[model samples]
Target: TLSQHPDKNLHKIAHTRSSTGPLAERVRPNQLCDVIGQESFLPESPLGRLLVEDNLPSLILWGPPGSGKTTIARIICRVTKRYVVKISATKAGVKEVRIIIEEAEKRCALCQPGTVLFLD
Candidate 1:
């Protein structure tokens, strides 16, 4: 279930899972500058500029396992200070999307920060 205050768990989620989760999670980069191998998306690039402006548009990150898709999403959420709602597209149906959208509408009505619908 989506929490009314999703941002409340942002810090807790990032810190708590890294300690006991997989090695990859434990060593994941917390900032865009710390990521390697994807230099095209780093600072000085268009994506980097957008991130700096905090105006990153809806994007789709497609990559194989072990890639930095989730890591990038986390960094975006943190940098933008937005609520994140992660959903697995493979398993998600219209029902899930409707729920997320509805929650986003509520947030917007309240003048809260935007929600990042990170479809994994």
Candidate 2:
């Protein structure tokens, strides 16, 4: 399990490596279909079920930092097999956001492959 890895000692291997938790250690999801969370909106919401089941759509997780928003988004991207693009409103400007959206929109038929935009 990732929880059991010697993440604390990763500093010895790489000075830039973080040791907060496994959640931030990895990037992108291994499988979107395997994502977990948002049970309350399941079976009812179209987009919610897609996120929890089909692993499709752009996800805008609105909340403060360290709230599992990025973790959940990462999981969804993994299971869905769609391209995952991460961005931060804090660091990005409207032009940058537009560029990312335009690029992500180009995925699949709309514009590559399917995309799961995860904005933090």
Candidate 3:
């Protein structure tokens, strides 16, 4: 009877829906609590504590592939209420950078929190 059930394919359908996105995109953490590792570089660290409190200075995150740099950047921007404009250095040129800066300036002038230019 189970083999002849009309919903026999339900599990396959659920699996397909759950695994729709790319592996990396699907697994990317949406918040700090979901992030793993890099504990020493977080607010707990001496140097990082100041940055976390102020959340003002521009940061340059350098690390190997899959090192959670993007995740950390996202978390910082989210916590600071900053807008994020992601750009790729390899594809973006001076013109794009200038445009982003001008837009950021306008947002800042409006008393918006700030912007984080995540250069990937």
Candidate number with the higher lDDT (1 or 2): 1
Q: Candidate 1 at 79: error in angstroms? A: 1.7
User: How high is each candidate's TM-score?
Assistant: 0.71, 0.51, 0.65
Give the winner by lDDT. Answer: 1
* Candidate 2 Cα errors over 4 Å, as ranges: 1-38, 41-49, 52-55, 64-66, 109-111
TM-score, model 3 to reference = 0.65
List per-prediction Cα lDDT, in the order shown.
0.79, 0.58, 0.72
Report the lDDT of model 3 for residue 7: 62
Off by over 4 Å in 3: 1-18, 41-43, 46-54
lDDT, residue 56, candidate 3: 57
After superposing all C-alphas onto the true structure, candidate 3 shows an RMSD in angstroms of: 7.9
- CA RMSD, predictions in order: 10.3, 7.1, 7.9
Per-residue lDDT tens digits of candidate 2, residues 7-115? 6543443334444545345432244322345453344667656655665544466667665566666666655666777778688888987887777666655636676
lDDT, candidate 3, equals 0.72
* Candidate 1 lDDT over residue span 27-114, tens digit each: 5678887777777568799989888887777888888987788888888877887788888989999999999999999998999978
At residue 14, give the lDDT of candidate 2. 39
Arrange candidates by lDDT, descending: 1, 3, 2
